[model samples]
Target: MNRVNQVVKMHLRNKFTWFLVPWAILGANFLINAVIATSLNDGEVVNTGAIASIFIYTLITGTLTLKETFPFAIGLSIRRKDYFFGTALTVLLVNTISGLAITTLSAIEQATDGWYVRLHLFELGFLKDLPFIGIVGINIILLVNLYFIGFTISSLHRRFGSMSMYIFFTAALLIGTITSYTLTHFGLWVEIAHWLANNYMDLFWWMIPMVGVYMIISYGLLRKAAV
Candidate 1:
């Protein structure tokens, strides 16, 4: 078989890469959102709900190391560039699809929150409208950028991926969850939560560059994996 076809075939059939991890991640999101909607008051439409989706996605994308996934490319005889491009393509494709899904979801969320009247929400001077096609395009750009950043960072050094993910997640979980709990349940962390609510988007922007860094680093990692 031609090398390109082999790579395609491998990608088509790769169990670990396409099945277990991604599906499990998607399933986790589904289950959580379901529980949030059914069990919790003011669920699925709250910032906390959005945070859960965003956080899980961040952790999964951040922690996926090239070392662990390289094995899946074995016997494909593809060049490093070919492998990198192919893998990145798959990720982008998945992300674009996800963006469409999220756009539809956000519309539903808005309608629900608006008491089924589809109220226009002026969020910080931004329009509440998110056309499905527009959001799909936006998500495409987002994933491309994120993949580049993530690849660069992962490629920076071999040992940093999952370890970095673990440390950051743990610290944030400890502090953020406590803060969140206090804000929601006890009102003790109200001040901090208010401050965060005011600047959470700023915080999210801080991580975008890191994803590109990981993708650039993965370029080298892909070479090593090819060898």
Candidate 2:
């Protein structure tokens, strides 16, 4: 337990890891959107993809956490299991804080009528009706899912090699293409969309099991990974 905590501390030793980058990314996006909104002199500028930038940033950070920190942790005599768990915990903590902040910002954006510019940036429409806690929960779940996807990919690369990573992605693309083709062939596109519309919230629930699967796969790969 102490070792795990130590590993967690090691990741947090750099202030930029947990402190600066998230806000910087979000702030930059908000500033860009605000400027655009001002220039257009239009009505409310709704950015449906406003949150995407931070999510992508988190995904990239997840891979970097392993690529950069895993080697250092291993050199410090840290067990792989401890490092894995500690990284997972750090991701959870960081994303929870991020979720709360974003949720708060969304509420404030609504209260202020989009920072008084009528620019709907973070306070997106799909989530506008959800309660504050619900919004936070959704963000946390989505963030975790994205983080672990990157973590799992990096772990596989560490366990195997660049070639294996390429092969894995190729296989994934093949599978996705086949699935898409099957769905299209059956003409289930509209039905699928309707199903998703009916159960979009349920998608968040699936993230829990997806996160578990990612954890298992990442851990399995990490156990065999070398620095």
Candidate 3:
């Protein structure tokens, strides 16, 4: 492993303090899922707190570097590329583990009710087919992409180095809102909505192809940038 990767792995291994993340996530998830479960009696619907926990954790870790912590990463010889990769790997690992834990921890009324059957990491139940090997493959691939996502987020807007993150986040929200509104209003989903929704795995599979693109772009982004 490279120095950056090693540093990150160690940080992940030393996650005694990082347990705070999951605790916070658990608190948030209970609040959110309590309302959801009360309204929806379905076991899967009510037991969504596990999924909620992972989502909350990722959002927090992914945005951690938005604050300038160059001194921290630099001392560890963690390149910008490495930092995000490590962070993403950490997020994916944490989420996947957290996902399983949440699924197991969920308190359902019925004996066999659960929402932790996602075959693909991104989609809720992407890996419902493969039995054993399929689950393993999906997990491995997810870890890779999450590392890539972490890398991508880490390398961006480091030059402004200060409040650029606020700007970046604001701009991202603005762009996302406009794009979502446009796509929803436009006839973008006229035909494939059902197919896409029913076979949502297809949507997440697109990430498999996009991973390479993100890695390459992230590398160039962190090439000369100080983070």
Candidate 4:
């Protein structure tokens, strides 16, 4: 337990990577979008979707975490299991904080009528009707899910090198393409969209199991990863 905490502290030591960078990117994106929104006509709503910048940054951070920290932690005699647990805890804590920050920003956007420019950066229309807790829950789930996805990819690379990653992405691309074609051919897109609209929150909850799977895979790969 103490060792895991140490691992967490070690990661936190690089505070810029885990903390500052994401928000800095988000702030810059928001500023640009806000400027654009202000130039538009009155009553026009701008949905920049710029809020995703932070989540994408979280994904990139996950992929880099193992590469940057694992070797040093191993040299310090940290066990792989402890490192994994520590990383997982850090992910939860960081994303929860991020979720709260986003939710707060969204509330502010609402109160200020989209920062007084009608820029729908955080309080997106699709999510506006959800309760505050629901919004926070969904955001946390999304951030955690993307982080673990990147972590799992990093683990795969660590376990099997560049060739494995190339193969994995190739397969993913092929599968995604085929799935899209099938859905389009069958005209299932409309139905799928309707289903998603009705059960959007439920979809975030479903990611919990996938995150568990990612954790399991990452742990297994980490156990055998070379320093």
lDDT of each: 0.53, 0.87, 0.55, 0.92
- Residue-level lDDT tens digits of model 2 in 102-212: 899889999988887777777867778899999999999999899999899989899998998789989999999999999999999999999998899999999999999
Give the TM-scores of the predictions, in the order they appear. 0.54, 0.93, 0.60, 0.95
TM-score of 1: 0.54
Best by TM-score: 4
lDDT of 2: 0.87
Model 4 alpha-carbon drift over 4 Å, by segment: none
RMSD (Cα, Å) for all candidates, in order, is: 7.6, 1.6, 5.8, 1.3
Name the runs in model 3 displaced over 4 angstroms.
Answer: 2-6, 13-18, 27-50, 65-70, 76-96, 99-111, 114-151, 160-192
Clashes per model (N, Cα, C within 3 A)? 21, 0, 6, 0
Question: What is candidate 2's CA lDDT for residue 186?
Answer: 97
Write down the worst ten-residue block by lDDT for model 4.
41-50
Candidate 1 RMSD to the real structure? 7.6
**Native-to-model Cα distance after best TM-score fit, residue 217 in candidate 1, in Å:** 5.7
Question: What C-alpha lDDT, on a 0 to 100 scale, does residue 221 get in candidate 3?
Answer: 66
Candidate 3, TM-score vs. the true structure? 0.60
Task: Itemize residue pairs with steric clashes in candidate 2.
Answer: none
- Please report, as a residue range, the 10-residue window in candidate 2 with the lowest summed lDDT: 42-51
The parts of candidate 1 lying over 4 Å away from their true place are 15-45, 51-59, 62-65, 71-75, 114-127, 159-227
Model 4 over residues 88-127: C-alpha lDDT tens digits? 9999988999999999999999999889988888886788
